[model samples]
Target: MADRGSTELTNPLGALTLDQLRRRTSMKWRRFPPDVLPLWVAEMDVPLAEPVVRALTEAVALGDTGYPSGTRYADALAEFAAGRWGWRIDPDHTAIVPDVMLGVVEMLRLVTGAGDAVVVNPPVYPPFYQFIVHSGRRVVEAPLGEDGRLDPATLAPAFRDATTGGRPAAYLLCSPHNPTGTVHTRDELSAVAELAGRYGVRVIADEIHAPLVLPGAEFVPYLTVPGGENGLALLSASKAWNLAGLKAALAVAGPAAAADLARLPEEVSHGPSHLGIIAHSAALTEGGGWLTGLLSGLDANRLLLAELLAERLPAVRYRPPEGTYLAWLDCRRLGLGDDPAATFLEWGRVALNPGPEFGTGGAGHVRLNLATSPENVAEAVHRMVAALD
Candidate 1:
């Protein structure tokens, strides 16, 4: 059977023209100068799915803009999880929040007190550092293995240090980890659960990118592990469906952690937009076909990126990300010092996320957004090659 593609199966997730994308006021396009090809942010440069557009349009037609309420988002998410990931979700155990990071912070607050240690893996997400700090908690780094994947050897020490001071602690996990796009496996997650349970460190999972797992790769929900019955997971349709501007996410507690989630202040739910809930719920329910198509497109782009890097920027080392639209490029071979993203931005006029900002082993690297068109991807590469010249 000749496999066609997700775009061919459902809707075509278009890669809009430069002029088409620049007119928008979103952060990805708006943050950069007119001459720069902006590819730093996680925002996709594609149009919304038919279901999402319809949901938002219907909301506006009915003048239904108000504060968010009810479990429709949770219900939709439960339905989606069962169909996609084979995980049974209890809608009653889920609650709505403004976004994933905020939900993580609230979850941290639920499990820990001020000055408690929050162990994290880096070259991970940049915000994992900021949000933990903002929560008045201490940040402990457990750098990933040399392969850019979680290692028990590194984690065990971090867990011990975090709990040694007899301070309360939590493990902030980035499943389908950001920047590197390393999707933690079932066995890996089970090992993590065992370690966390052994050390009595609460696990807080940020699974915002759960739905974007590339082809041939599987995304394992941390809470589904053996010892995760007391863990908390933050999920949303924002990343997969490119609905970040909509502002709504869910906090899902494992069987035993529902009480901890319930302790979250009611005021926390007040921040999510009503339209955001409608759109996210619609994405989970009616946007599957579109997501299928988008994934096919991303799978193509991920491979295309590897080929492009190999052809033009041979000095730059890149691994086709296991998940997410972001590409972490190691530019150490270029002798570009600590921050190659800055050099690329200034010389190539192509803005990428500086690696050092991602902490620990992040230097000598740059994160490239790959959720754009193939042509644009090629153009970005051309610019990078020119920068090196």
Candidate 2:
């Protein structure tokens, strides 16, 4: 059952019409043909929070569209952290980046040399493969457990193999991991911290989805564990607040690794959009109530998604995601061949992220974005069933 009380309590996050969204020029709508319903990409279909819009509007009005720099973004994130999560972020130990992946790539350069391995848990966010490979490093796969959780049995060997032959390596971690939407517990993260310390491998955590954790689950910041003092984390308001277009993220350093973070090239700060910093800062500082409302709506949608799937496409096995709006559907049983996304797009005219692109265990799956309205969710399932038929 949907949380009717909670759903009504929050400001509605999505009420999008197909025509209204079609008018936009972003990748989500543009990548597909006019006939296709796009459920691909991490993009959300919601109105901007008033604070974010007001901040960006004020910046434009003041002609403040110059280069971005300063402590305001960091301070806002720090405040958001203290309130949302219990961690105390030091603004001095943070740097602003154009986005999360760029920050991870830069952090990789700081820690690893060319051809050294970078570890990732697959099936993961697809960019983890590209960014690490393009940066002249090999991607070492530490695929998640069949249960869709991180297993130390897999990590222990992967960490050993990754750091073998005196190679400098780093673990590129995805907290509240993408695709699967698994919110890693503190114990799991503590185990990872211990493993990283034992293997002398640096950890770079992409916590972009930190703020989207659904009810009954908790999101643990990677650097908060005991052995995580030397780890680096990337934080952003882009995911929670739907500000990807004009948003930047912060790279935070654990206490022991402050000097290493300072070594990040000063030029990196110049990549942020001037309006991005202002918008992101406003989201963190003044958008708390709006965020609370957004979470409520997303929570309702998660349940609504399950009910629709059960009624329309019961054979499709779906483990309801704990965090993020993305749902990883095990489509192997649907008999639509190895790549289910291709079939869905061709037959149903509903586009989704191809599972194989996420690597390893991703071959028979597709990731569905649930950030749209409940009507879209039901329509997507209807289209999917029609495709399978």
Candidate 3:
């Protein structure tokens, strides 16, 4: 279902209409009432890539449903990395987990202990705070710069504070960071690797959005940087291919951190579904063309959101994200206190993610999902504008 030319690609976001999407029973569709336009979570509105659907259907038809085995997922990811970003991944250095967040927690456990501090750059994915705290570790914040990029000056102090009293600590980094959609540059990540090295803090990068870097931006795999040889990264095709319902992700370790990753409990590998592995492998290996189309669609949606906000909700400040289908909107000018998402849902009949939950810099903001039709994106803005009246 794609139109391709030498330089043009079909916009996947335009494929489905609002009525078609409403038939979905996923959390993004079901969490709000029928009248509300739900644009809150990370879920995408696109259909599965032909390759992934075919692979899954074949597996089911062949009665291949059993526990996961072999290194197909890792191998496919290695191939995707090499082809997409010119990065190399040693399958021997990877581990499978249920999803990105769980893998982050597991990697944290590998290097840090209970009550130890785990530093994060906020307004980040809210689950980064929850999973860290729930795993018995304390959360530390190093808020991003005013420009929505990582600030080394801010991180240094947080690193020092986290390692106080000789306490072991880990830094949970969201590469191509969430909510804000600021794609961290190679220079920025190299600085982070250098800083983490100086402070003896282990880095666990959540790189789930690595594959979705839109036009005009580059995604640097965390482990590929010079001093990042000691860091661990979590990667998945779930976000780019809309396979969140089929859970699976990879925990890859840098050369220097390989031994540490090997220490993970064998039982941890049991968490991912066999079908999830099959689906993820197929997507990474054969869904490249489909992903290219999705990225094109997302690129268009980001711009459309910018235009809609400029015309209708001029008070809202938004920087089209460099990566991910998520948009972080600064709504403080609308006079909606700390949480504008609540007001939007109640008054606008639209469901967006509450900003306060993202920690630190989240106040007076809201996170909107932009992976839907242009019509929905425009309508969501229209509804939000109506809320203000």
Provide the overall lDDT of each model, using Cα atoms, as 2-decimal numbers: 0.90, 0.88, 0.91
Q: Write the residue-wise lDDT of candidate 3 on 251-323 in tens digits.
A: 9999999999999999999999899999999888778778888888888899999999999888999999999
Local accuracy of candidate 1 as per-residue lDDT tens digits, 1-389: 11112233443545567798899999888898999998899999888887789889999999999888789999888888988898989999999999999999999999999999999999988999999999899999999998989999999999999998677799999999999999999999999999999999999999999999988889888889899999999999999999999999999999999999889999999989999999998888888878888888889988998999898888888989899989999999999999999999999999999999999999999999988888888989999999988
Candidate whose lDDT is highest: 3
Predicted structure 3: lDDT: 0.91
lDDT of 2: 0.88
lDDT: worst 10-residue window of model 2: 1-10
Clashes of each: 1, 0, 0
Residue 268, candidate 1: C-alpha displacement in angstroms: 0.8
User: How many angstroms is residue 180 displaced in model 2 relative to the true structure, after the best TM-score fit?
Assistant: 0.2
User: Which digits, one per residue and each the tens of the lDDT, describe model 2 over residues 164-245?
Assistant: 9978899999999999999999999999999999998999999999988989999899999899999999999999888899
Looking at model 3, residue 360 earns an lDDT score of: 97
Where does candidate 1 stray beyond 4 Å? Answer: 1-13
